[model samples]
Every structure is written in structure tokens, then in C-alpha cells.
Target: MNRKIIFTENAPGAIGYYSQAIASNGLVYTAGQIPLDPQTGEIVSSDFSEQVKQTLNNIESVLVASGTDLSKSIKLTVFITNLSNYPELNAVFKKQFDGIDPPARSVVEVSALPKDVSIEIDCIAAL
Candidate 1:
């Protein structure tokens, strides 16, 4: 299978030893995205809802770099520090996916996340 590493200035740079995403065959697998600002590389906000939105935006950038978009997402796995943010997550999803068919997803509440951010998200999408 052919594979390609993906990167973009529109998203936050990888803070570790990993590419932002990888495209192989016809699908792109993205690394978990935090709520960091692409230019500043700093956490975008302390608000849970804002963090979710920024994380999703970063995921979208990676997807676009891999020649796909959020509408093509096949699956998503969300890691959040608090399950109480569930309602806010769903609300954001409703707005982001609005008319488009949303992808299959799993939300996992964890004790912590990198950078102590409230949330992180990763996705698989067709390219």
C-alpha cells in the first residue's frame, strides 16, 4: 500500500515524534489533535467548548492536507478529561456536522490528557 505523511501550516505542528497524519491506500489517519493554536502553538482556550472546537479545527486541517475533509470522516475517537463535557461535545458536533452525515465516534473520558488540555480528537477519513 502506498503511504504518505501529511502536514500543513494550517494546523499545529506535531509536538512529538509523529507526523500530523498519514495517508495510505485511500484513507487518512490523523494523530490526536489538541486545542493548540497553529501559529502560536499554545492552548487556544481554557473553556471546554472552545477547546473542543479548536481540536476539531486542527483535525480538519490535517484531513485537508491529506486530500479529504471532515465530511469524509469515517471514524473518530475523542479523549476528554471530563465526561461532564459530553453535552457540550454533542452540541459542537451538531453544529459542525449540521447537514453532513456525521462519522461513527467514541468518546472516552480519561484521567488526563497531554498538556493538561480538556480534550483531544483523532480521526480516520477517506481521501
Candidate 2:
């Protein structure tokens, strides 16, 4: 199957040598999305909750660019600097995936993220 690169102005561009996402076979694999503003390439907020929301929104933009959406997500991987922020993270996750059954998910704590932001999320979605 041929892979198609996915991109959109609605989401921040990849920082290094990567596309925002790629659609291959029947799935769309997104690069990890931080809370960076698409227009300015700056982290959206210092607050962890705000970071979580923006990250999800960024992922959604990439998905939409690929002709799908968060509701089509099959899996999600979250990177956070603090596991202690789990409750807030789940609250935001629930809000992002409120209607349908949410994606299968994993959360990992990292030593740091690009831009020193608090959270990042990447997902695999059905096309």
C-alpha cells in the first residue's frame, strides 16, 4: 500500500524531519502532537490541562487532514512529564472522546518533551 503524507495549517508543523501524519493501508499514524500553536509554533499554555486540550486538538486536526477524525481513532499514546497529573489528563481525555468508545490508549512519562511542554499525544486512526 502506498503511504500518503498528511498535513494541515490547523495543526503545528513537524519540528524536525517528519510529516504531521501519514496514512497507510487503512490507518493514519500521527506524529506526536505537543501544545504548540499552529500559527506561531509556540506552546499554547503553561497549565497542564490547557496543554492536554491543545495537544488533543492538534491531533484532531491532523486526523481531519487525513479525512478522518478523533472518533475514528483506534489507538492513542500519551507522553507526559508527570504521572501525578493522571487525573487531569483522564478528565481531558474523556472530554475529547466523549461520545464514541475512545481509542485504546497508553500513557508514558518522559523526562522531557520538545519545547519543554507538559504533554504530547499521538494516535492511530482508521481511514
Q: Which candidate leads the pack in lDDT?
A: 1
Candidate 1 lDDT at 45 equals 93
Cα lDDT tens digits for candidate 1, 6-116: 999999998899999999999999999999999999999999999999999999999988889999999999999999889999999999999999999999999998899
| Model 1 spans > 4 angstroms off | none
**Cα RMSD (Å) between model 2 and the true structure?**
0.6
Report the Cα RMSD per candidate. 0.6, 0.6
Clashing residue pairs, candidate 2? none
TM-score of each: 0.98, 0.98
The best candidate in terms of TM-score:
1
lDDT for residue 66 in candidate 1, whole number 0-100: 88
Specify the poorest-scoring 10-residue window by lDDT in model 2. 91-100
Instruction: Write down the lDDT that model 2 would get.
Output: 0.94
Residue-level lDDT tens digits of model 2 in 16-87 = 999999999999999999999999999889999999999999999999999999999999999999999999
